[model samples]
Target: MLLTTAAVMSALVLLASGGAWAFTGWASGRLDRIDPFGALGDRPEDGPRGALTFLLVGADDRSGLTREELDRLNLGRDEGGARTDTMMLVHLNRERDAISVVALPRDSWVTIPGHGPAKINAAYSFGGPQLAVQTVERATGVRIDHYAEVNFLGFLRVVDALGGVRICLPEPISDPRSGLQLPAGTHVVDGAGALAYVRTRSTAGGDLDRIDRQQRFISALLEAATDTRTLSDPARFTAFSETVLQTVTVDDGLTGGALLELGNQLRSVSMDDVTFTTVPAAQTDFTAPTGESAVLWDTEAARELFGRISRDEPLAEPSPPAAAQAGGAAEEPAQAAPELIVPPADITVQVRNGAGIQGLGARADEELRAAGFNVPVPADNWVGGTVEQTVVRHAAHRADSARTVAAALPGSRLERAGELGDGVEVVLGPDYQGVRAVEAAAPDSAGSGGIQAATATDNVCA
Candidate 1:
């Protein structure tokens, strides 16, 4: 249905060092190519030595869908054109252990070389991938060594081939525009559902939330793609590989051997090594000379960000709190403050009925999900038996995530547990009331003073 995630994650998983173990030269040889950088001039200088940066875009091509399929999928009639629906930069550090998938907002206001200022996406509509690459390089000063684009198909095939990918939502979304309808909870979705999930932006934070969905789905797909069972099964891997080659069009220079070499370098990479974030914005709505409202990047912040990328460094470290900065000694953030790095949507939760009331746990689960917590599992009996007071128990390392949960339960007390792992557990007591809405910590509030970021290991879906 939609090829958004494959444009980056699958490429990162299947084409880069991870999927090349069984991938043959024949498979790489079959990939179609469009030289994205060949005709461009005044390109930016190369980035950090030994680092590889690839620009990936999802090409919303519907030519392959039949009339019935298009109608069924609700994809409009074919509009013959070259335009990308979304764009992302995939950067791999020199040793290839760490990677960052940075989302570039399509509506970012930027100069398009000869085209002057326009929405970043307009570059592709004007000159296809060539100008798109040129514009991005000109705007960010980061050299793109390779490019690959995904069309409208194969996303479904890959997800279906793997049975399905697991997804967890903090809030329920019902967007008719994208034909996505799902409740808030743990879900293992098939191909069609995956398409709808990635395409819908009706949720809160709009594009930012959509980026979160893509990152989550990508993590799930990559998780399935790397599982020993899927890799060992020749039929499944072959089918998945075929879909990847068919759906993706790479730059002529991104050859099979080149991919194999990079893929092998990143074999040791885990989901934790990959970070997902969006480009920081100074203004979300800037009026252009053409009367278009586009996003504006925070110049100074973005420069430092791109410099770090060019130098093959991780994201800028978050700043210390005001108190810590003043005292020169680090201290825990004031409790009950909305300063958590892991947003509520990213926090995994389990609801248990300790109040002894039938179905109370399920109600709490639904209420928590409605309040934007990821309740991956349904309500259940409390493990430690009944208690008089509601309590939030979590692993010590996950105190921030735990605080996010406690914020939803007005009077819930905090407890530490070693067995609960990374997720937080809530045991409802007689004092338990209804859930209250809680806002995720703002980016600036989180001390990044940039855009929010998370790894697959930290994201809710994974």
Candidate 2:
């Protein structure tokens, strides 16, 4: 879902800065236009303002591909219907200083306009992008400001134009259906490989697993596009901008100036500032009333998430309110919850190598120390041997303290360990990608159909 959005965001920045002058004008003229939200007819009076939320749709429809290209890419004819394999609700904060990209599981059960309950993606299949936007608004109770659409072939060209994207895999994968065959490590993937990576769903976690991979793919793509080598090279920037504009279709509102505004707002933000997560959902095999298997969103949690977005509040934690004048009521000051806030200087951490990769422990020690944690315990091999997921063990009384430490190292789990005398012990596992601040907390925690987040800065293998 974000593949198109990420590419467009980078292009918009280049356009806004006049970095691709000739290409920008030419590509801007060639951009495909769509009335994505026009069918909805009217905007709600209570719709959110100040912030912008875009409904990014990735269509599996292959309508515009040439016969030879389709055959070459293994894409069959268009089935006379449109279905989005991926949908994401992207939110830009009021200040445009941060971004939260929420992936919407296409299989999630929701109501379609003029139709009863069905898989959310079916809305697009039934009526196109307009109905898809309507269904999302009705289901989440959050108003969407804009829409963007891209097809499979367009995605391929864009990635190829940007050279290639690098992705890290913890284990080898060979999915025949998607044509993605790769070893267990990092590789720079070309267009076809990128498509296969995101399309394959035979992995362990099912659609959920695919969703995670897609999110990671978006981050990696953005990081690659923003690299100094790509940015400084005019030829690379021109090719990227041209391919992206030709590839993506946006609602009428995202004109060149509007795009420049968006790009300017986000100019200073880094990949580290952007966060990606999925909409809370539970996997289910139960048949819907429409006779289709669907993913069920945790209704209670989903509602709360939309509510926060409606008020323009940050989803992770309390946001500072607008300040009031001297005679007026002062806005409540936002603060990190006690459970989430732990000063790096307050605790000591022991680094152990469980990843089997040589010098992993020593690297972790250096990273933790730079992050302000006291790494008094020298890096050593873990007695427990090689593990899969990273774990942070701490004394019983310092569970919250451990969580704080884990926050600094995103993706690591917190556990109880009386063996660690005072602080926490970080055993870097095979899954240990790197050290970076974990994303903000979600409305619901993991394992409960809540949002799972990953930082764009972390190159962790998905």
Highest lDDT model number: 1
lDDT of 2 by residue, 253-343 (tens): 8776676567766777776567666666544455787687778876766766677667776554322223442333222211232344334
In the range 305-340, model 1's lDDT, one tens digit per residue, is: 777778888864322222332223222332444465
- Write down the lDDT that model 2 would get: 0.66
Best by TM-score: 1
> Model 2 — which ten-residue stretch has the worst lDDT?
328-337
What are the runs in model 1 whose C-alpha is more than 4 Å off? 1-3, 16-23, 287-293, 317-449, 460-462
Task: Report RMSD (Å) for each prediction in the order shown.
Answer: 8.0, 11.6
> In model 1, which residue pairs have backbone atoms overlapping below 3 Å?
16-263, 17-263, 17-264
